[model samples]
Target: MSKKNKDIEVRIEETNRTIKGTNYVINQLSIGKKLVGEVMTLGAKEHEAFLGDEDLGSYKSVDLAIEAILLQHNLHD
Candidate 1:
């Protein structure tokens, strides 16, 4: 595996799981071994995503949140 692939593999091994039909994740990101940020999805179609302890807010769809969050971080950078 490539270095990026290895990094992803190490972080994501058992963090993905499904209950009912909705997907929940306990995502942890790090640079090498140093801790970074974490995010989580809660609920079904209509849901909220959390960043650490902050509310990223609610969205009608994950796609919407994905676009909005990416744009948000891009602005920060």
Candidate 2:
């Protein structure tokens, strides 16, 4: 892990809205003060499973992906 990873906390926020007459929840994630990303929930079970992860459950959206990418890059704090 690199210093950058240790300094960052990734958070995901869920938001719901209608697009083209369809309702969808968007997962918006913030990483420290640097990066942001989004993810889409396909089903309740899937979302719940995702939320079950100890390290990532609290993150609402793209935080998981961002964390994975950062970890892969060894960008730890």
Candidate 3:
């Protein structure tokens, strides 16, 4: 295969893998695997952060953010 064709094939494979991973994560979250992990930040202000419509209070700190998510999941269960 040509180099261009090989690159395209690689991209297609990567896309397929990403789609599969996303589907698996969705399935797990649906099964109640909430509070996955904490987001790594360089500052106090977050640029982009959201997980569904889950109102998980304010982000006081990384630990607090994680704690709030855990509480949310515990309460929902």
Clashes of each: 0, 8, 0
Q: Judge candidate 2 against the unseen true structure and give its global Cα lDDT, from 0 to 1.
A: 0.49
What is the full ranking by TM-score, best candidate first?
Answer: 2, 1, 3
**Candidate number with the higher lDDT (1 or 2):** 1
- Selected candidate, larger TM-score, 2 vs 3: 2
The predicted structure with the larger TM-score, 1 or 2, is 2
C-alpha lDDT values of all predictions: 0.51, 0.49, 0.36
Encode model 1's per-residue lDDT on 1-77: one tens digit a residue: 65553423223222665768877764444335744334455656664544435567877765665555545544654
Model 1: lDDT equals 0.51
What root-mean-square deviation over C-alphas does model 2 reach? Answer: 8.2
Query: For model 2, where is the 10-residue window of minimal lDDT?
Result: 47-56
CA RMSD of each candidate after superposition: 8.1, 8.2, 16.8
The lDDT leader among the candidates is 1
Task: Quantify how close model 3 is to the true structure by its C-alpha RMSD in Å.
Answer: 16.8
